[model samples]
Target: MNQQYTIAGLDLPDINPEDKLNRILSSALEKTNGYLINKSTSLAHYWDANYFNLDKVQIFQDSTPAEQSSILQLCNLGILEEAYFIEKAGMGYMAKMILLAETISERMLYGLFAADEVTHFSQISSFLPTPKVSYNPFLDLLENVVESEDKTVLLFVLQVVLEGWGLTHYRSIASCCQNPHLKSILQGFLQDESRHHATGVTLLENRSLGKSSQNIVEILAMFLQMVQLGPQSVVKAVEQVKGHLSKQDKINIFAQLDTETHSGSRLKLLRNLIDLPNAKNILENLEMKGSFQPLKPSQCVSFNCS
Candidate 1:
C-alpha cells in the first residue's frame, strides 16, 4: 500500500461516489490553485543572501561571495518551503474558524480567508520544483492551536500576531527578492494580509481573553521562544557550505549573526502586536518575568535550539 498527502489533493477530481458531495461542496468553497502561478513562464530565481543582511554580518564577510551565496541559496529554499506549508495549513485553520466564529460577519470573513489561504498556498508552492512538505515547528504549533483553541484565542494568535508579524516579514523578503514574479506575489499578499491582520485586531479589541488568557500567553511564549532561538538558520546555512562545525564556529557565527540585534527587532514586533487593551495586563505580566529577552548564544548552545 502507498499513500500521498497534501492540500493539493484538494484540487484533484475525486473518483469515489461517496465523496461526490464532499468534492462539490469544497470545490465551490475554495479557490485552490487560482490558476495564477502558471501565469508566468520565467526562468528560475536564485537566492540573494542580502535578504538576511549577511554582508553586514561579520561571519560571511571572510568567506568568498560564492560560498556565501551557496549557503544562502539553501537557506532561502528552506524559508520558502516553510512559508508554503504554513500557508497550506492556513487553508484548514482559517476554514475551521468559521464554525467557531461568534458572529456571522466573522464566519463570512473566515470563509473569504479560506480562499485566501488557498491562493497563498498555491502561489508559494509554485516556487519549488520538487514541492515536498517539510517539518516546521511553527506549523505544528499553528495546527495544535487551531485544533484546541476557541475563536477569541484563535483570532489573537493567528490573525493579530502571526499575520501582523508576517506583514513585515513578507515585505522584507519581497523587497530583497531577486525574482520579480515572486516579489509581486508576496506584495499582493500583503494587501490582503494587512486587512486580515486588521480584522483580527478589530475583533480582538477590548475582548477578554477570559479563560483563554493562560493559553494565549503559553502560545505567545512558544512564539517568543522561536524569537529566542535567534538566527540559527544562519548557522545552518553556513554549515551547508563549510560542513561540520565546532562549538567555537557556532559561537563565532552567533556573534556575526548579531543575535541580539536581530532577536530584539522581532521581540519588538511582537510587543507592538501584543499591545491590546484587554491583553495589557498579560503583556505586563510577561514583561515582569522578562519574557521578551533574546536567547543568549550560551543558552542555545547548551540546549541545542535546533
Candidate 2:
C-alpha cells in the first residue's frame, strides 16, 4: 500500500473539543435552569423538544401516538450508527489499512476527525429514548466497503459520499431546529465533515488512476445507487419499528419523505457533489461507458440554487 498521495493545504480553524463540550454543557444547563434530568447530560437535553419539529414533520404529526413513537425511535438510530462506525474504524480491517497507508499528518488529522465523530455520537446518544442497537443497514454497507482492497475507494465512499451526506443533513437540521445549543454542536460537526469531504476530493483528484478510474467509477455508481435507495429503506425501517400504523399514515409518510428527498437540502448537497471536479470527471467517464448520462446545469437544480 503506497501512502504517497500529495497533501493538499487545508486552512481549517483550530478545533478544541473541550471548549465545544463545555459550551454544550453550559447551554444544556441554561436550558434546564440547573435542574438536570436523567437525559440532560448536554445540549441533547433539548433534543426531545426541538430536535424534530413534530408539526413540520407532517407524517409524524398525523400518525397515531404509538406510530409517532416508533418513527422517532427509527430517527434516533443515527446515534447507534455513528457509534458503530467509530468502533469499526478502530477494529475493522480496512480502517487499519487506511491508517497504515496515511502519512503522519494525515493520520493525526484522521485521529481528530474520529474524536469529533465520537463526541457527536455521545451527544446524540445522551438524548435518545431507545437503547443502542447493533444493526443499521447503512453502517453495514460502510463496513463492507471498508473491507475492500482499494483504500481509495473506501476513502471516497466514506469521506466524500457518506460524510458529505452527513454534512448536508446536519446543515439542514441546524438551520431548521430552534435550539441554539443543538445548532452549535451541529455546526461544529459540519466543519469537521466539510474538512473530511474536501480532503477526500483533493486526494481523489490528485491520484493518477489510469485504468483503475473505471473501476472507481463503477464503485461510485453503485454507492450512489445505494444512496438513492436509502429513503425507501428508511421508510421501511420506520414502518417496521412498530408495524401498527394505518396504511394511509404509511403512505403519507412515504410521500412526505419523497418530496423532501427530491427538493430539500439533501438534494442540494448531492447536486453540489456533482459540481466537484473529480466527481464531474467520474460522471464523464461513466457517460463514455454508456452507464450514465451527464446532467446539464439546468437539470441539476437544487432548493438552494435559486
Candidate 3:
C-alpha cells in the first residue's frame, strides 16, 4: 500500500495564544531574556510553559556558584541559538499541525508546547558554543538520500529525527528534575512528543521504500546515526562541569545530575521509545544494524547562496 500523507491529515486548531499557559511562559522568558522570538509559522508551532500549567513547574533557580555560572552560560547559548531554533521549529510544527494534525485536544496541545520547548531547552543548555556546521550534517544526509526529489525530506529530518531526539532528551531531563513541578511539566511534554514521534514514524514507515520519493531505509539509518552523535557535545560540557569539582564534590554532583538525567521513565523513554519495534524494523530495512558512523559537518554541502 503505497501512499503519500498530506498536511490534510493534520487537524490543527487555531489556538488563541492568549489562552495558552505556555505563551505566558514565553512571555516570561522574553522578560528574562528578550531575545526569544515568539512567532509561529504555518509549518511550525510554538509552545512553552509560560502559557500552560499542565503541572506546576518549580523553577530550578538555585544552584552552587559554579553550577549557577555553568547554567547561565548555557542560558546564554540559548539566547544565541536555542531561542531561535525554538521559534523556528515552533513555526514549522505549527505549520505541520495546521496541515496534518487531526482535531487538537487540550492534552495534545499541551503536549505539543511543553515537549517542543523542553527539548529545545535541553539541547541548548548543555551544548554551548554551538558549532557552525554549514549544512546540518543530518540535513545533508537527508538531501542525499532523496537526491532532491522532495522538499518534504527536510521536514522529516527536523520533525522525525532532530525533534525525536529532542523528545528523548526532554524526558531524560524531566525525570531527573529536582523540582517536582518541573518534572511534572516535562512529563506532560514527553507525552506530547510520543505522539509526534509516532506520527512521523508511521507517516514514513507505512510506505514502502521504493514507493516513496525518497529512500525510506537510508533516511531511517541516517536519523539513528545522527541521534547517537547528538549527545557528544553535551557530554563534553557535562564533563567540563565535573572537572572543576573536587573529587568528593564531583562524586556528589555527578550523582545528582545522574539522578536528574537517568531517573525512572526517562531512561525507559530514551531506550525503548526511540528504539521502538517499528524504528528497529526501519533500521534493519536500511541495513544500518552495525555501529553508527560519526558525522563531519565539513564534509557536508556548503551553502553559497548569494
Candidate 4:
C-alpha cells in the first residue's frame, strides 16, 4: 500500500490501487477553496468601463492636488514598475490553471477569470502612454510554467508563493498613493487576484486528496524552492534590491502585511485546504523564511520620461 499524506486535519484513507485517477482528482480538489466573489452579470462590464480609460479616470477626483500628486507618483511607479503589474495579471491566470489541476469546481468560471486576465492586459496595455516597451521577462515566466510537467506544482509556485509576494507589492503601491481613484483602481485590480488565490486554496483542500497523491507534497516543496529562486518578479525584486533594506525592516514589513493585508484571508483558505497542523507548520516555515528583497526604481525601469 502506498503511504498517504494526512491532509485537512484528517488521516487520508489508504490509496485505492485500482483507481489512480480518482486519487489524483481528489487530491486536486482538496487543494481548492470555494468561490468568494459572486459572479454578477455586470461585473465584466464594470471592470472594463472603469479601469480601461485613462482619459476617464481623474485620480481621486474628489481629493486635493496633494493627493493627486501622490497618486501620480504611484501611477508613475506602476507605469515604471510595469513588470509587477504584468506578472500579477498573468499570475492570476496561471493560478487558475494550477487550481484547475486540483478540482472540477468552477471549471467554467476558471476559464472566465483566465480570459479576464488576458482582456485586462489588453485594457491596461492600451492605456499605457508608451505601450511599445515590451516586458519579455513576464512572458518568460509564463512560458516556463506552462511547459512544466505538473500543473499542480506550478500553480502553487505561481499563485500561492509568487502571488503571496505580490500582495505586499500591491499594498505598498496602493498606500503610497494618496489619490482615491488610483487607490480604487489598484484595489479593483487586486480583487480579481484575491479571488484567484482563493480558488487555489479551495483546489488544494477539497476532500478528494486521498492516499495516492503524496506526490503533491513533494511537488509543493519543489514549488517553494523555485519561488525562493524562480525567474519571476519576486525573485527579480530580490536580486535588484537585495541590499537596499535592512533584514529587520524586511521582516517587519512582511509581518505588517501578514496582519494588515487581505492576504491573511487567503492564508485562512490555505489553512482550510491543508490539514490544520500541517498548514500551520508549512505557513510558519514560509513566514520564517522572510520576504523577498525590495525592488528599486533603478533596477526595474529602463526608460525615463523627463
lDDT: which candidate is best?
Answer: 1
For every candidate in turn, the CA RMSD to the true structure comes to 5.0, 10.4, 12.9, 15.8
**Global local distance difference test of model 1:** 0.73
- Residue-level lDDT tens digits of model 1 in 99-151: 78888998999898888887787677667644454445676676667666477
Candidate 4: what lDDT? Answer: 0.41
Report residue 214 deviation for candidate 2 (angstroms).
Answer: 4.1
Model 2, span 263-303: residue lDDT tens:
34443455466455655677676446543333222322211
Off by over 4 Å in 2: 1-62, 77-98, 129-135, 178-180, 241-253, 260-268, 274-281, 285-306
Worst 10-residue lDDT window for candidate 4 reads 41-50
lDDT of each: 0.73, 0.51, 0.41, 0.41
- Backbone clash pairs for candidate 2 read none
Model 1: ten consecutive residues of lowest lDDT: 1-10
TM-scores for the candidates: 0.83, 0.61, 0.42, 0.42
The number of the candidate with the highest TM-score is 1
The true-versus-predicted C-alpha distance at residue 97 of model 2, in Å, is: 6.6
Cα displacement (Å) at residue 228, model 2: 2.7
